[model samples]
Target: MSLVIGLTGGIASGKSTVVELLKKKNAVVVDADWIARQVVEPGTFAYKRIVREFGTQVVGADRKLDRTQLGRLIFGDESKRRQLNRITHPWIIFYMIRDCVMSVLMGRPFIVLDVPLLFETRRLLWLCTVTVVVVCDRDQQIDRLVRRNHLSREEALQRIDSQMPLQEKAAMAHFVLDNSGSLLALEEQVENLWQQLQCIRKQRLRYYKLFGTICFGILVGIPLCRSIATHL
Candidate 1:
């Protein structure tokens, strides 16, 4: 069995950097954003639904989702954003669950379900053994967004404000990874957390083995015992 960890952070909060560190350690990660894109590929049901709901203006000339346009359409309109989530969240959840099950069957040590909106949606929280939120100061986040995405401060702030506040997310998380300082400092935190999760994985594996053994005894041992007693 795998320990499923839910990893989340507001945009530009260094969540992807943490994910990269985990990947380097050979961690199994089910990325919700990647899955979201997959679920809405041009021919998929989600693509069809999105086009129908928002019209062709949301689609680019290449017949793919104009993510920038869609982002603009929803960021300022709370109702439309919820409507979009309503259309896509279920499909994303389905694929995520499938990936997690596959990881469990493959006996991965632990699986990370990386989601940007883990706290905002709250739909997949029940599936996680532990939750981690990567955080930085809001101003730092906005600055990173502006520098990385080439957005104006106002545009960057709009993106940040669209999600649940970083402080609130940190409060909700079982573990919080602070990325407000140097990359080396953040790496140290990730290393320590990885070690902790490894210990938890070992504990979970022991419990799973014990449970399987007990189940096997119930299924096979009782029948053999009954037969021997009857023969006697």
Candidate 2:
């Protein structure tokens, strides 16, 4: 069985860097953001539901969902944001699970479920053998967001506040990658974590094989033993 690692982080916390390193190490990654976009493509069920709920104004001239307009509408209103989440989260999760299962069936060493809202949804957490959260200082996070996203400091803070607090997520994670230091430092941390995950994956595979063997013995051996007793 492929080990499932749920990777998450707050905005501007350098989670993408960790994911990149994991990819370099040949880990199969099932990204929730990528699945979310696919689920809302023009012809999808999610696209129709989003249009019905948010109106045609959220659709662009190209007849695709206007993500910028939808963001503006939902970000400022908690109720609308929840409504959108309700409409899209299930579909995103369904695809994420399918991809993860496919990766396991392919016999990959391990797979990363890179989700921005892993902690908020909570349900996805159960699907992972381990949860990794990338985090940095709050001020550093805001500064990074302001620079990277080209938003004002206040806007960055608002966007940060819109999600669950970074501290809470870090506390919840089985492994925490601290990104408050330099890029090299973060890279080193990721390398060490990847090694650890490999060990864990090997251990899990052994356990699964042992369990399967025991189950097979119980099913086949019992029937064979009964047949032998009947012959006696």
Give all candidate RMSDs, comma-separated. 2.0, 1.7
Q: List residue ranges in candidate 1 displaced over 4 A.
A: 216-232
Candidate 1, lDDT over the whole model: 0.92
Can you write out model 1's per-residue Cα lDDT over 1-232, one digit (the tens) per residue? Answer: 6789999999999999999999998889999999999999999998999999999999999999999889888877889999999999999999998998899899887789999999898888988999999999888999999999887888788889999998999999888999999999999999999989888878878998999999999999999999999999
Query: Which 10 consecutive residues of model 1 have the lowest summed lDDT?
Result: 149-158
lDDT of each: 0.92, 0.91
Q: Write the per-residue lDDT of candidate 2 for residues 1-232, one digit (tens) a residue.
A: 7789999999999999999999999999999988999999998999999999999999999999988788778877899999999999999999898998899889887799999999999868878999999999999999898888787787777678889998999898989999999999999999899889989988888999999999999999999999999999
All candidates: TM-score: 0.90, 0.92
Clash number for each model: 0, 0
Q: Candidate 2: lDDT of 215?
A: 100
What value does the lDDT take at residue 37 in candidate 2? 90
